[model samples]
Target: MGNPKQKWTNEEEEALRAGVAKHGAGKWKLIQKDPEFNQYLHSRSNIDLKDKWRNMAAAVQGSREKLRPPRPRPVQDVPAVPSVPLQTPTVVPAPVIHESPADHVKDESGKDLPDAKNGPRYTELIFDALKDQNAMDISSILAYIEKMSDIPVPPNFRKPLGARLRRLVQQEKLEKVESSLYRLKTNTVETNASNQKDTWPRPHPPALYTKVGESLEEAAKTAAYKVVEAENKSSVAAEAIKELEKFSKMAEETDSILQLAKDIFDRCTTHGEILLVA
Candidate 1:
């Protein structure tokens, strides 16, 4: 564990593979014994081999699971592995030398069909073209893409190639051998492949519970009905109280008027002035 937690670069990994291929598996000491064998991983040990293989196996298994859908398995199963080296070899893109600019490449109209997008882009095509060759320049790449592309070559294709190549170099997908000459980078493809990390497994939302008798709106309606009925009763009672108070005030006013009249009458009788009235 001398290099514990240290990420293995693609060059170091390739060296390990090449070492294993040259010497054979389970003979990491033979690969480590020779320094020139592992240029990037010369300091690695047999222990490193065991750890790296474990890590790679896990990575390959995980990658396969992601890329492929689950398939039905037979009840009878036999545990087997097809030569371990076959499992880990980098898939070299098949060489694409010729191009088809025939009418079949286009649709009914002159507006040509789309170039490769979802499967593989121009960059990948260029890399595949150069895989068997030594190196290539921007002119060579442009020519290749134009020939392979449908009917009419895309406008400003040369300008885009320069920019695309520069970007590829920046992304470490391609190496600039000279000023304009480029080649597919050996170490870049495998190193940052797992850069898009998987998100954490989120717990599902908590379950909600409710009684089955009534819905939320129905329950609210029932409560509102009770409140409205109580308010209506209270309003009727309040109106009755107000009517009683008004009647009492009128009776008091009538009593005061009668007392005044009685006083007037008593004074009139004392003065000997009694009148008969209808």
Candidate 2:
């Protein structure tokens, strides 16, 4: 007994015709799976089927090019320009001097302008201090600013500081974790915390299974529900690990089969005689 003879359908032929017209052939495997191609021929796994469709498409395209008419070249004309006479140059008068750098040196009170770098305004000093602290909380930042400079920060300035912090948050230059607490944008500690209080809780020491069991037993005496829930979670985790191992084995087998099919398809399609048989 022999295998049944596979024939290409009219729909498959049309899909090959359109695909070649659009993409200009190649990538046969991709074309085979296309909805338009799949509607007629369903075997994407068979490379021989794709090769047949490609060969048919090539013949159709060759015939189409031969039948198409040659395009004509377009003609263009150059334009002419008129001649013009040149004009003479003229001299202009100089303007009067207005406010110069020396004129701007004094303010309305006739006092010399304060140095911007050494003598920044109260708000500038506060913001600069906040930046130096890497965006710390308002209280800590203000305290640090007072210690560093002689400038007195008014109560009203706190509102502006809050607004500046909000702007910095939007600009991604500072981050606000809680209502008042803030840290640098990069999540790195930039300053020494010698004066800072230890408000955050300490981390527990790393423990083995035996230590964990002893801890659970101790916790059960204090709270049974918490201990029971933890034990059940551990059991559920063990079951999940077993299921994951099984799924991994199945996936490996499936991948192996797919690779074998791909290798066979590659060999059969490239060789003409194998494709004829396929």
Candidate 3:
């Protein structure tokens, strides 16, 4: 006869869920081999794990169906009767509200399950978790978010949580300090420590100050040399100006001599004309 079928314990189910969350579904062998979950699921085979997960999923779906409210019946159109005038005015009624599918989905414990697809809320939750602590590993972050959340976090939440953290790190909104540890990008690692003081723009040593003073002295010497060079250039410019003035005087004298020679030539021509007439 076949061995008696063993019922799945809560610990085994939890371990299986954790394994599925970490390694992903369909990797039954890997999940079973995982050390973290092996203790709980050592006796369970891969086939058992797969069947158990399927059953769990089916049970959840069935419970959700049971919790779902029945659809409202459509009202058929009726012929209006002739109304008699009344002394009092008629009162209007409020519309009937129907529950959505999300509202009906609850865990076995009757707690509302958290939506893994809620990206913005998840982002806020991660930020809130890291804001209080200096740094936290992925597990701690997940635990903190779960503790603070009003709804029960799903077992597959770890997969989504890892993805969200990677996205945040990529976006530069969060910093990954180590392999699994994460913190806010803007937050310093030593923020929690009170004894540590900021030491930015550290003071220069006496030797550095002495070097700076020497540099200043060299700069002053350079400036003085430049001033001397400027004075020498000024002197050369003055000499050039004096030479120009001398050249100008020589040009004027040359012009006067040319004019005098022209006047002498004109007088000689006039005297020769006078002699030829005589």
Candidate 4:
């Protein structure tokens, strides 16, 4: 009857995280001993601490493949953009094809979503979203898109959206006020093929993927793994080889944290026990 078995709050979770960081995850007892942690988590048992850690770990290190970054821009399937940079795009010229209305994206209900006839471009959606707001980050944009549900998001859509945004910035359709936060350019108009420059740019982006807080070494490793992933999906050995060369040096310096994740991911993949985090 003491605390009425209150649910875990964000504060308690943060304290537990601090505890784990101070004294590795295994030493729950030590964590509980420290006032930094114990003061906030006194009611919880060591078992609860361990279990919470397990849940957090599982969530963070979900599928092994996801641990590997996808290729930048759209190189076939894997958008190859880091969660942090989510770089826009590069000028690689390719034939631009506009999607048709008849081929509108269908939802799970098998009904055509709104604005399906128009080309389902990422920039269009983002531009539309920011029309009213000042700026937004990827998470907010993603959440907004999910909530609106006007357009059906493709599977693993983040990379593609990032790639599109990068292209939009390149085309001067949008501007990045911050790394993640972006705003519509004052001069920018509704982006369409006619308004875009005639010079067709390479649709694919560079292979480099660097997270904001992560070391360059780790970023390089992510790029290499991503290249491997791209090769696996598209069977484009030549392209993968080319991209792999870009990150050749970075892949060799795997830190302890990355090494541990790799080991766990590899083991889980082998056992087919890796489930996509829901």
> By summed lDDT, which 10 consecutive residues of candidate 1 come out lowest?
204-213
How many residue pairs clash in all the candidates, one count each? 0, 0, 0, 10
| lDDT of model 3 at position 102 | 28
**Candidate 4: clashing pairs of residues:** 70-80, 71-79, 71-80, 72-80, 88-166, 92-201, 92-202, 93-200, 93-201, 93-202
Sorted by lDDT, highest first, which candidate order results? Answer: 3, 4, 1, 2
TM-score of 4: 0.28
- Clash pairs, model 1 backbone: none
- Give the best candidate by lDDT: 3
Positional deviation of 157 in candidate 1, in angstroms?
0.9
lDDT of each: 0.46, 0.38, 0.49, 0.48
The regions of model 1 sitting more than 4 angstroms off are: 1-120, 193-278
Q: Provide the RMSD of all predictions against the true structure, rounded to 1 decimal.
A: 43.8, 34.5, 47.1, 20.1
Q: Please give the ranking of all candidate structures by TM-score, highest first, separated by commas.
A: 3, 4, 1, 2
- Give the alpha carbon lDDT tens digit for every residue of 101-179 in model 2: 2122223331211211211233345456656775567767656655565333322234334544554454455678777
**Alpha-carbon runs more than 4 Å astray in model 4:** 1-121, 188-278
Winner of 2 and 4 under lDDT: 4
lDDT of 4 at 187: 70
Model 1 lDDT tens row, 164-259? 566566667778986779987887455773232212122221111111122223223333432332333343436666534533433333322222
Per-residue C-alpha lDDT of model 3 across residues 114-230, encoded as one tens digit per residue: 222222355678888888997998878877876776453544355446655765675567788977899988844534432221112312110000001112223233234333333
Q: TM-scores for all candidates?
A: 0.27, 0.21, 0.28, 0.28
